[model samples]
Target: MGEKTLEEISKAMRDIDITMLSTYAANGAIASRPMSNNRDVDYEGDSYFFTWENAHMVGEIENNQNVSLSYQGHKHFLIAAEGKAQVIRDKHAFKEHWNADLDKWFENGIDTPGVVMIRVDATRLHYWDGMDEGEIVLS
Candidate 1:
């Protein structure tokens, strides 16, 4: 029934492990895929997801940096984030966001060749829960 702060929204996001990451496809169509957060969400208007360099989403992000992420949690909490994406290839950056859960996808973990990280810097976050809904703009 009241506006929510970024911190409060971040707290709600902790329980959300997967988010739908949407991007603009090369064919001018909107594409979306489920991305695991690996519970690495510290919020602060930023989110990260790892995928292979050759993945379709990577190509999509390359063509268009603008992206959106959708998240749903218990208690009717939902979030939609609009942001810009950067594809990171640096190993150091990989290590920073890497976790054991990712080993299931990347056989060698952070050392896995062709592994790339997509960093989404959210410029705006909109959320809804029950009868409450609000938006947070990040500068």
Candidate 2:
């Protein structure tokens, strides 16, 4: 019923494991895919995801860092986050967010040859919970 604080938004995001990452493709079309957060929802306006270095998403990010992440939570809560995405290649940074569940997707875990991390630093977030709605702006 009021403004949503960053802490409150972060707390709500913990329960959301998947988000629809949207990007602008080179063909002048919007591309979107479901990306798992791996339960690393400490928030702070930054979200991370793992993908192959050669993936189309990586190419899209290279051409346009502007991206959006959409999350749906319990009780009809929804979040639409707009941010800039970066492709991280450093294994040391990967180690910080790596999890066992990802082993299913990337064989050899962090050692996987094409593994890359996508970091989205949110600039604006809009949320709706049933009839209540609010937005948060980050610097």
Candidate 3:
């Protein structure tokens, strides 16, 4: 097995927009949600996401660190990555992902009380249906 070059992974992320993050409850049922990509950390060591600690998704993440994210678009390409999400308490990063949309939920602006960021370190990524099909590439 070989590693996917940073450029390849970056291309895949740029070619796709949304990622479906799948998590679970203590009961073992599955839940999936569509989230916007950071667009800034495609091939970086970690992918960053913003979520409220009080949100339902945070509870699900606490129950299970293992997560699966899938990305697909009109380009007939699909990518699924298995990863572990960890909450980041760093204030600078939280402010970096913050936008006016976050103001809707956080009264204190980017430094809201319960605001959190999840950094996912993907261990495996499977891509298909792009310029190459049946290639079954892994990263």
TM-scores for candidates 1 onward, in order: 0.97, 0.97, 0.77
Tens-digit per-residue lDDT, 1-139, candidate 2: 5587889999999999999999999998999999999999898999999999999999999999999999999999999999999999999999999999999999999899999999999999999989989988898
Query: On residues 4-118, what C-alpha lDDT tens digit does candidate 3 reach at each position?
Result: 5656667768756578888886789888888766564456546777777887778888778988888785567666787888777788878766666656666887677887888
lDDT of 1 by residue, 1-139 (tens): 4599988998889899999999999889999999998899788988989999999999999899999999999988899999999999998998888999999999998889999999999999989998999899997
Q: List the global CA lDDT of all models.
A: 0.93, 0.95, 0.71
Higher TM-score: candidate 2 or 3?
2
At residue 22, candidate 2 shows an lDDT of 98
Cα deviation of 19, candidate 2, in Å: 0.2
Candidate 1, overall lDDT? 0.93
TM-score order of candidates, best first?
A: 2, 1, 3
Worst 10 residues of 1 by lDDT: 1-10
CA displacement after TM-score superposition, residue 130 of candidate 3 (Å)? 4.1
Query: Which candidate, 1 or 3, would have the higher TM-score against the true structure?
Result: 1
Q: Global lDDT for candidate 2?
A: 0.95
Window of ten residues with lowest summed lDDT in model 2: 1-10
